[model samples]
Target: MKTSRQNIEIEKGHAFVTIGMFDGVHRGHMCLVNNVVKLAGDTGGISVAVTFEPHPRMLLSGGDINLRFLTSLHEKEYLLARAGLDHLLVLDFNDQLRMMSACDFVERVLVGMLGMKHLIVGYDHHFGYGGNVNSTTLDDCAGRHGFDVSRVDALVDGDVSVSSTLIRQLLEEGELGRANSLLGYEYILKGRVVEGKKIGRKMGYPTANIEPDWQFKLIPADGVYAVEVTTGENLYKAMLYIGTRPTLETGGNRVIEANLFGFDGDLYGKDLTIFFKHRIRGDMKFSSSELLSKQIAKDKDETLQLLG
Candidate 1:
């Protein structure tokens, strides 16, 4: 997909667009994106996914909020590209854009800039100054701007709407199975390998300590997980730990470390992407390192079985 910072001119009335933070690009977001793509095809227009960088909440809160994201900008871009969008426009959610009124945003950005001939949005999607604009307002804007507006009904799983918020809650509670089902894919954490105390190596299960690439990227709940690890072109079955070393008495920050099965390498300073498959167990305070080692061995076995 072509990505743009500044709007490019498309043929007049040839852009089918959807707009949102698209945090996880979860199933719900995909519903709208896919709809836009289909609508573009039906209407002889180009499909465009318009998202903002740094998340509007981050800018609005002046970085005071503790909100974490399901996907970083890069990850979101990758997902949007894979979703078959014709173009991806990332706008800077700066003061000037934030200050624009609802009507102004519609006319200036969607109509004037994007050449939006048709707009597809989630059923309850809202935007513009303080997000006071609603679907009704969008319909009115469409009337004046000479375009069409369509709303995709919420995608639901067992009566609950599929949403990024719900997915985040599931991840926080380590409900990997449900979260992945709603997401239509496993949750991923991307990071670079950092040096650790080499305790896992001593335990005979070497691990690559991961420092997440994005400060706001949400790490799943503290636990051991069955994961698929990808570094460059290689994929490995792995067991991942996300917590402090309670048994080792390592009093420090929480760490993300992954032990790749049947693999040996120096990964320090390299990047690793982890796709969480299942929660093996929550963080535990074993009475001894020997006990912890045994538990890890159990986790590895369980991981192999799950992955297999």
Candidate 2:
């Protein structure tokens, strides 16, 4: 996919576009994006996806809010490129863009900049300041701007709607299966190996301590999880721990660590990606290091079975 940060002037009436933050690129987003691609093909126009950087919430709240994201900008770009889009335009979410009214946004960004002949959006999506603009308002703008609009219905699983918010909540609650089902893939965390206290090594279960690359990436709840670890073109079945070392006296900040079963390698400073498959158990404090070690062995056994 062709990607650009600066606006490019496209031929009038030659592009079919969709606009959203598209966090996670979950199943709900895939539904709308697939339609955009199909419509673009049918109309012989370029399929353009317009997204904002730093998330609108972060800018709107002036960095006061502790908002986390499911996908970083690079991850979002990679997923959208794999989804078969013709172009991905990343707009900077700054004060100037935020101040644009609903009508001005349509005329300036959609019509004037993108030359959008057709616009596709989610059924409940709203834009502009305060998110007061809806599909009806877009329809009015489409009529005045000489463009057409289409809204894709929400993708629902059972009674719940498939959405980024719901996925985040599920992950926080340690509901891995449902969250992965909504995402249509395993939830992933990417990071670089960092140094930690050699406590696990003494217990005969060495681990790689991970420091997430993105500061605002959403980490699931503190617990043990069955995960697939990817590093240097090799995949390993691993048990991941995300919590403070409660069994130790020096327990302080939360740490993300993983033990790769049946493998041994030096991973200091190397990058690794962990794909969460299942939640094994919640974090717990043990009476001694021996108790924690025994429990970790059980967790590893369960992880192997789950991965198999």
Candidate 3:
């Protein structure tokens, strides 16, 4: 449960470690973690996970900042803890660590810093500077380091490999049901409910707006979703909207808005976690505000039924 910024000496004991950025910790990642935990249990080693912060992609490419995220650090930690892991090592993704060669990474970070006796990586394990390291190199390195390696077989369901990218694609395509199935849980996005133009309220569909911590947190496709809204304490069945308001005569600014069904309470400036259950409809351009309002009502009813 200890989170350290400076490197801590790897406790002098055997440990099973799973390595990845683990952005969403979706089904595939969970598989790896579970495998490590089970293996560690058999080997009398600690179950540990190594993940990077500020996703390496963001550090590598300063691309579009608004990619929606499936989970925040707090969410990831909570999920991992629930999965029965013993330790979660969140390393800072910085240039210094990035420069380490594959061999050095295995020796210094995984072995020296983590004291991993068994290393469990995904089927396609690649790491080190420029990602030039592969499975062969890892096997050789493990042999030299006197540790065990477990390469988890690819986790696939028919045409789809359970992956963070696949989950992101599903979300982008508004495939909430399929995405949730692959994720093994509801796909959630964490953000603080912030102030917004009072457009939804004026239209009689008040919204609790969300502003995520990372701009690059990948958002699902622009659509209305059946959602469960949690503001750290209370959970509510609701309709969540993620899109630019086309009906409102305004500049196109993408926004995340959620309408809690049959619940009225102040949510301004509070953090909210939205769990997407199903996609109801794609964002649309209505002929009139009245038309948009009518559609919103229908969306609400659909979401209510979905929750039920």
**In model 1, how large is the Cα lDDT of residue 44?**
80
lDDT of 1 by residue, 1-308 (tens): 89899977688799999999999989999999999888888878899998898788898788855789899988888888888899998899899999888889989988899878998888888888888797778778999999998888999899899999999999999898999999888998999999899999999999999999988999999999999999999999999999988888668689999999888879999988999999999999989999999999999999999999
Per-residue C-alpha lDDT of model 3 across residues 1-308, encoded as one tens digit per residue = 44455565556557788888776888898889999889888877788888888778767877446555677777788888888888888888889988999999999888888777888888887889988788788889989988888888889887878988888888888888888898889877878988888789988988988897656677889999999988778889989888988888567899999998777888888888888888999999998999999999999888888899
| TM-score of candidate 3 on Cα atoms, chains taken together | 0.93
Top-TM-score candidate index: 1
Q: Sort by lDDT, best first: what order? A: 1, 2, 3
Misplaced by over 4 Å in model 1 are none
The whole-model lDDT of each prediction reads 0.90, 0.90, 0.83
Clash-forming residue pairs, model 3: 65-215, 65-216, 67-216, 67-217, 67-218, 68-217, 68-218, 68-219, 69-217, 69-218
Global local distance difference test of model 2: 0.90
**How large is the C-alpha RMSD of every model relative to the true structure?**
1.1, 1.3, 1.9
Candidate ranking (TM-score, best to worst) = 1, 2, 3
lDDT of 2 by residue, 169-220 (tens): 9999888899999999999899999998977888898999999999889999
Clashes of each: 0, 0, 10
List candidate 3 stretches off by more than 4 Å: 8-10, 62-69
TM-score of 2: 0.97
Kindly provide the TM-score of model 1 when superposed on the true structure, using C-alpha atoms: 0.97
- Lowest summed lDDT window (length 10), candidate 2: 57-66
